[model samples]
Target: MIAGLFETHLKVADLKRSEHFYGEVLGLELAHRDETRPITFYWLGGRGEAMLGLWEEAPENIQRQHFAFRSTVPEVLRAPAWLRERGLTPRNFLNDGTDQPMVFAWTPAIAIYFTDPDGHSLEFIAMLGGGPRPELGVISLEEWQSKL
Candidate 1:
């Protein structure tokens, strides 16, 4: 049985730009940079915890993708402002202008969405300690807490 995700790859429009975003902006640790290939790697949580690979490709060849980083509830609460301070816009799951994390009633997880330079969707998510409430649908953290 699979324990957890170990790695994921994304096609980036520019390797250098993606490197700065992941290494400097997001603060992931640099693992390796291949000189023979237009690719770079970073450690997600800690060294050897998880890995993310960015492969440089032409814009036409790059397909947008989505992925989420495991995060804590407190960090998720602060994500919107943290992202804004870094010159990024934090968005809800629906991305309808609201800049707050939402709780998915089904999984009851909190998550905030954002995009990378190449428009690849990214997320910071944390699971909540509760049973699923699918009927309540996706709602704001405040609304989710009020029902608790």
Candidate 2:
């Protein structure tokens, strides 16, 4: 049976710089690190919901990717400002031409997008309550089939 997800890893360009950015700037705690293996790991949250892992880059190209973290309003507010203070100005917190906080319709979540020092796109999102959840709502079997 599937239990839960423990962690995720990323191949960072510079271990030193990535450590400084994720550990110091992002306020993530350094849990375990091995200079010999040249890999570092950071623990996130009290219950370890997520982990920040860094690995040495190989000769192959490192493809840039994006990831999002679920957070509260306070965290959402702090993220943009924090990025700005560090001179990493985001393209925009909210989508361009919209006052909303870079959100999607029918989902009560706000997302913020920015790139890391190595040009990896990262996002932080906050979920709001009272939004439509398919599992929580009832639907007729015939209606569902018809829509599909």
Candidate 3:
């Protein structure tokens, strides 16, 4: 059986721009890089457990993918405003182009969705336990947290 997630790799369009997003904006550490060779990689989380890698590669068709970085409940709640503070706007899967406050995925995780520099869907999620599995895939964070 699989133990747990080790790492995830994403093909980014621009190394410098994507590095800034993941490094500065997201605050993941720059674990590895090379000055001689044309390669850029980053590691998130601890050496054991889970991690993420950013690769310097151009997309072929660029089928966008969604990934989430685990965050605290308060952080998930504050994410939209925090992103907005840096002039980065958050969005929802509904695609109405409005900054979604948060989403209660019925798995009972509170998530705040947004896109990276490469248009990859991303989220900060907090697994808040105990909630009815609603058929409505996305519920407002306020409504979910209010129930807590």
lDDT of 3 at 56: 65
Computed on alpha carbons, the lDDT of every model, listed in order, comes to 0.94, 0.66, 0.73
Model 3 spans with C-alpha error above 4 angstroms: 35-37, 59-61, 145-148
Best of the candidates, TM-score: 1
Cα lDDT tens digits, model 1, 1-148, are 9999999999999899999999899989999999999999899899989999999999999889999999999999999999999999999998899988999999989999999999999999999988989999999998999998
Clashes of 3: 0
Tens-place lDDT digits, model 2, residues 1-148 = 8675568888877888989988887878898899689789988764466677888696265678777766775676567676778777654343463222443323545566777777787887776544544542332223333333
Clashing pairs in 1: none
Give the Å shift of residue 23 in candidate 3. 0.9
Q: Note each model's CA RMSD in angstroms.
A: 0.7, 7.7, 2.5
Clashing pairs in 3: none
RMSD of candidate 1 to true structure, Å: 0.7
lDDT of 3 by residue, 12-99 (tens): 7777888788888877777777776445556656545566666667667456778888888888878889988876787755667766
List the candidate numbers ranked by TM-score, top first.
1, 3, 2
The list of candidate 2 runs beyond 4 A from truth reads 1-4, 93-100, 133-148
